[model samples]
Target: MQQQTSNQATRRGPLAGVKVLEFAGIGPGPFCGMLLADMGAEVILLERAGGTFASQLFGGGRKAVANRGKQSLCIDLKHPDSKALVNRLIGQVDVLIEGYRPGVMERLGFGPADCLAVNPRLVYGRMTGWGQHGPLAQRAGHDANYAAISGALDTGRRHGGAPWAPPTLVGDMGGGGLLLAWGIACALFEAQRSGQGQVIDAAMCEGAALLAHGLFNLNAIGAWDGRCALDTSAPFYDVYPCADGEWLTVCPLEPQFYAAFVERLGLAGDPDFAGQQYDTARWPAQKARLTELFGTRERAYWLEVFADTDDCVWPVLSMDEAPQHPHNRARDSFVEVAGIVQPAPAPKLSRTPGQVQGEPPLQGEHSRAQLLALGLSPAEVDGLAAAGVIRCAG
Candidate 1:
């Protein structure tokens, strides 16, 4: 694939001409910006004048995958001249994203009401752990907190085991960032017809809850208890450690698939394993038997055993092992950028597939050029940089 730069004119996706201004932040905010940038939006990351908590934490700004495909402009929102500078830029951009507490943007004078006054067609997307207006909206929280409060984390726990969710993936990226991006896209679409933009309140807690809708429906219908066929309590739909310490995921929910699984294991004649798939009363003993049976073989042995079967058993590859998997390699599921291996753009479109526009940028790396494009004179830009209202990197 040909490498593409962050130049807007050279972008080639469905969002090629869309303009987005992101108030730089950690977690979901940056992730949402990266999503839009990957879709060929002209995303201008308005970073803090000095640095961001993410930059300090990661220490390698150029390798931060979430910051890819963006031009950075570092500005002090607290500076007296900042409001005018930002409002001017807002007039030109189609979307504005910020992930701060409810009142922080209002305090900075760039709130939805404020920015919409300058540009009525601007889509203002606000991301938070709670929401813009709620009892816990102003409270401090993180991904785990959001997942826990939204009931998403609890549902994933085993019958007696404590709930544990993968950090960021459950709440931040899946709920907060991705949901906000979809909301922004919907709002942008509506704006094209109405010629008016609106604000999107994207809360991680709410997003997490939305993500668990299917589970919620099942639970409400009494079809799913704490221990069901879908959960790990069942022997057929669970992960087990092999003799080699590697793991395999075994899931055969359908009757035909279950037949294939038991037949492959040479247990088709055994009454203990040949019964109905959803025989809940026998799950515990069956799970124990399968555990012992799987432990007798290496993961590679099972992989070869089920390679051509519809038994739905496969290896659970680690992060380092995933990129080299045959299916992932065939699909180009990962890409290398500046010696760093990361996931490629997803949900491929046949005509205008998304691309990684460029490498991650440093704070203020494009400040001078972006500011000049906003119609600021070079002298004024230099003066603002000297006054510490803006930062310019070499």
Candidate 2:
């Protein structure tokens, strides 16, 4: 194997040597960059001279978990000299990620074709809610809008309730960011042999639809009514509030697991709970019974009640409680960086484990260092800072 370069030496994952130029954006775009950086990619964030709204709004920049593990260089993309500088940097990087409306990057002179001309092997990843070309491509939207249009959000709520989903997990992170990351990785692998790059047009709406394939399959086969077994319709597969207002997730889907759960709850012999699972006619009454019974005790009590069995029940831990859980602690699933607690890199690689490269960076924290490393002299970098072309933090 080729020896690791000085730049790659500080990093410790499979993508250590791979360089990424991420044009900073909100939502899925930054998330995609974060995932790549966590996997050891040397990501350089290209931000506006002052910084983005999210950079300032979230944790005063430090709490922006998505921007972690990356260096930052603040620049005015609209500056007369910015185009040439960015093109030069493009020639030296392996991938470019941008999340903008359809014509935004093209107007900025850094579209896929523009960047590919600078580096033929560059993998250009585009993240958006509607997609590159479509009737709604130019329309404004957010995570929920994308997921709602994709049909994923429609299947998420309880029957007769408004369709809802977690803020960004469905459309932004899982669908948009993750799909783009996977596409870039695949493109990178293909580039190794074909010696050519390709464009990945990852739309959050399309991604959200893709993520709901299983749900779609069920719907197609009529196996899913709006109030199916797993959609908060079944008493055994839903969250219940305890006496102390804490929550417990009860997902005893299988017969054996359900039997174990009811037995622990002292409902093993109840005529009301004796029917087999999926008896929808009995679900409402069963749920009412379970709700009343569970509300009689504390969440901790129920946790201890089924602690030793395979009841498939667990406490619905809040964000504060999750990190302190025994399983998360045992696996080091979360890590603290620069006083901020966030998730560590995932899908443990036995030979080349991923890691959080560093804390989230301030807007222009790395402007001078990054510019100097990009082959610009200190004098040039300082001149740019003085000219208002870039911002350099002390």
List candidate 1 segments past 4 Å from native. 1-9
CA lDDT, every prediction? 0.88, 0.87
Question: What tens digits encode model 2's per-residue C-alpha lDDT throughout 1-394?
Answer: 1111123238888998999999988888898998898889999999896667666656446678898888888889999988888898899999999998998999999988888989999999999999999999999999999999999999988777889988999999999999999999999999999999999999999999999999999899897885577788889888899999999989999988988888888888898888787788888899999999999999989888988789988998888888889998888888887676777789889999888887788888888888888899989998989888889776
Q: Could you give the C-alpha RMSD of every candidate to the true structure, in order shown?
A: 1.5, 3.4
Model 2 worst lDDT window (10 residues):
1-10
lDDT of 2: 0.87
- lDDT tens digits, residues 1-394, model 1? 2233445448878888999999998999999998898888989999886577777775546778888888888998888988899888999999999998989999899988899999999999999999998899889999999999999999777666898778898899999999999999999999999999999999999999999999888889997775677768788888999999999999998999999899999998887876687888888888888999999999999999999888999899998999889898888888876567788887788998888888888778899999999988999999999998899887
Best by lDDT, which number? Answer: 1
Q: Score every model by TM-score.
A: 0.97, 0.96
Best by TM-score: 1
